[model samples]
Target: MLRFLIIAIGAPLFLMAMPAHGFARLTIDADSQYRYAQSRLDSGAVDEAVAEFNRFIHFFPADPRVPQARFQTGVAHFRAGRYQAAAAIFNQQTVGFAGSPLDNQAFFMLSRSHARQGMIEQAIVDLHNLEALSSSTDVIDQVRYELGWLHVDQGRWNAADQAFNRISPDNRDRFQVANLKQSLALSGAIPFKHPTTAGFLSIVPGGGQLYTSRYQDAATAFLINAGLIWAAWESFDNEQYALGSMISFVGFGFYAGNIYGAVSSAHKYNRDQINAYRERLNQHRQISLSLAPSPKGAALCLTISF
Candidate 1:
């Protein structure tokens, strides 16, 4: 028979009275590994902390602490701004270890990770799940706030209102959430910059932007274009056209970025407006499903078709 020796946490250090006490059995030195990992973490050596914890997990694959180790690993990745890594780890834990003690926290973290990565729709789904899973008042409050923010970002004012309204008084004091709610209450969006001007500028080397009302884009186009103008002027004035030419070449890059930004913003604005319009076209469907009898205790069955 294969014997597995395990070092359990919080277990009594009593001498074993086995007939054959020797190094013949496989021993799991978890205590030492845990201590070393804890020491590294306390020392602020994050890389070493991961290394030690990884070793601990490798040595004790089936230990009860595995879930905790997984959570810590995800946390470490999150602290490092490795959001994709954190999301993957958290997602795996949430799906693979549903009943783990850290599942709620992991799901919350996964939502946050997706938010940071701008996976807005995915973030909303996870946030919704987190809200449902949260038992703590504070977490519930945060879920409402983040849910509101997600809807706001997507330009769903009615949905945003619903989410924001769910915020508890106790959590209303948070600056970020309060500010967002206040802004949303006052105006559904930050500011309405005319996408026409932005788009026009892009279409006509910044002229369209000026017409559409994108002053910033107009300025960028006008300012960045000086290279060609300067080059021509320099060549005309002092015959040192090479410097002006090089500067103009660099100016082309700035012009390109500005144009791209203007065009992108314009299209995004159009999409937003279209979405708003389409939202108004939504129709409500109601279907009622209930058991009813024409006569008391009669054996009657009915099916309604829509």
Candidate 2:
């Protein structure tokens, strides 16, 4: 009789475990979606890949894979050169899941997005945060290098120099070393006043790089500027630079280019300090909590009044 009773009681318990196997079905569904989407992505069927992922997100809203999908969506946007959209998505993820395992990865993507938009400071901040938060020292070192280079792009010599100096010798990335040398060279050129020319070049992208003695950057800016000026001169004269109008325009380009270099260098330096703080926050796992009993006012009640 006892054996019979045990079997009768166990029957429902065994039956109840059947639905628990549903996760396997869900796994198949998600896998199928991922594979289909990957194929679309590979074949350059961007719209199809996006639609498939969107469907998966709708079905598995609470799944851990949501972040990964969101990140992939953001990547697609980035690859498509939709940087503003990509930055928005990545930034949302970084803030939305602050302590999640995906946080570091999100920040890494954010840095890339900001860079694409030419928002160098914000990108540098994200890079520093990624360096601090991730477990890999190698990743941190690589970000440190990138952050330093972004600063160089904006013409911040002092900050760039300090950032380079702080790099761990063991993790010395050669690419970063070369950029640091470049930043240093530009920094050496920033302190003279050619205000009017500087102001003009500063307003134009890539002008500062040339002003601070970054030859490649200067050539790029100079050529573009010269072309524009030549076009304007050509509008009025057949002989471009031989004309007074063309000569003045040519002179202005050189002047603007030089001034832009100094200011850009200075701006980059200030951002490095902001980036360092962000890195520090990630390096340490910080929390503030008081040790007290679980119930509210437990500490007060336990203590007797004197």
In order, the Cα lDDT scores of the candidates are 0.63, 0.61
Task: Report the C-alpha lDDT of model 2 over 62-105, residue by residue, as the tens digit.
Answer: 76566667766776676677888888988888775444435655
Residue-level lDDT for 165 in candidate 2: 69
Off by over 4 Å in 1: 1-32, 38-47, 61-64, 96-101, 151-158, 174-179, 188-190, 197-306
Task: Give candidate 2's error at residue 74 in angstroms.
Answer: 0.5
Which regions in candidate 2 have their CA more than 4 angstroms from the true location? Answer: 1-28, 96-101, 131-136, 173-306
- What CA root-mean-square deviation does each model show from the true structure? 16.8, 17.4
The lowest-lDDT stretch of 10 consecutive residues in candidate 1 is 283-292
The C-alpha TM-scores of every prediction are 0.51, 0.48
Give the local distance difference test score of model 1: 0.63
